[model samples]
Target: MYSGQSIAITGAGGGIGRAMAEKFLAQGAKVAISDINTELVEKTAAEIGATAFTCDVASEEAITAFIQGAEAANGPVDVFVSNAGVGFPDEPGGHAAGGSNESWELSWQINVMSSVYASRALIPGWKKRGQEGVKGRFVIVASAAGLLAQVYSGSYTTTKHAAVGFAEYMAIMHKADGIKVHCVCPQYVKTNMTKGMTEIKEGPGKHLEASDVADSLFAAIEKDEFLVLPHPVIKDYFQAKAADPDNYIGGMAYRAKTIDKGHIPLQ
Candidate 1:
């Protein structure tokens, strides 16, 4: 589906970012992998024969430079994936427990503002093309926690929600300009972010693999789906929450208490 395209992927060093990069490269797309970890990014780039650049997505200058470099090397960026993110540490007084200001601010910058910066930098360039053969595309890898309240992480949930909201706004505003915006909200995937989480085995509510999530993203892009949910259960959960906000919150609170009891041992 992404044949003959030049794509730029942030956070391409590990986890879902690396999986998505491999998938895109296998489909005959030239990719530029960007990440803050220069060594890992370069290693992945060499392994996949893709261009590599060091970019801190939270920084406007870094993102702008990376985009310019990618365009210069691989022609116009047909697809841009804003996928860099950080998880709040599991601590009593951290963002996960809603205590520290630093953790919350840092999470907001990386998880939420990074997407905003990428869109701000690239949308103008995309618009300048003016009704091209194929529209430029942007995808934000949000989390299912965005749509549903998370058990502990306040910063992660809040920032991811903002990311999804921004993606929706971008889609609504730029659809007429031939810009395709998509938000990927996946549940617990087997990634570094969820490495130490308590595994839940309730039917299909179990953890999803990174490659599976990446495959879902490819399908979503092919269909031009706005919300790409790797975990189908999350859709039902979202609907249930939307149907009855009060009941949903009450249920979530109950579940949170249960999860907390289990998490105490892990901590």
Candidate 2:
């Protein structure tokens, strides 16, 4: 479906980002894949036959360089995926703890500001072309934790929520300009991000392969959908929460208590 298109993806060294690169390449798109880790980026690019760049998405200057480099390597980017993110150690008092500051800052920079930096770099050029009715796709790989919440990490949850909101704002404001903005929200995908975490077989979640999430993403792109829910259960959970915030909070509190029994450090 993506034949002959030029695509750029951040955090493409492993996990969902790598899966996305593989998927797009399989569909015959020219792909430029990047990661903060130079070795992983080079390895994944070699493996997938994609152009590689080592980029720190947390830095706006680095993001601009990556985008410019990708466009130079391939062509005008048809799709740009802001998929880089970080999960930090949990804070017992959320943002109130002293140690939480570092995690919070990192989470905000990577999980949230990365999307903004990508948008800032893309939107102006997109608008110039979009005014002529040309289409450009911006994909943000946010987490389902944005819609509900991550019980273990306050920084993660807060930044993901910001990511979702920013994507929505872009979609609403720029759709008429022929810019397609999408947010992919998935839960429990098997990725480096979820390494060392125990899988929950029951409850409001289930684990999925990174490729499964990639498949959902491609499907959403095909449909030009704004919100991509790789785990359909997340939609149900989101609706339930929207329908009754108090009830949702009560249930989440119970789950949090159950998951964090003994109130020990979960890192």
Model 2 / residue 227 / CA error / Å:
0.9
lDDT of 2 by residue, 98-171 (tens): 34678789889998898899888888888877335447899999998889877777777889999999999999
What are the models' TM-scores? 0.93, 0.93
Residue-level lDDT of model 1, residues 91-180, one tens digit each, is 664444553678778788888888888888888888888655557899999888789976677777788899899999999999988999
| Backbone clash tally (model 2) | 0
In candidate 2 the C-alpha lDDT for residue 18 amounts to 94
Global Cα lDDT for candidate 2: 0.86
Per-residue lDDT of 234 in model 2: 90
Off by over 4 Å in 1: 89-97, 130-133, 260-267
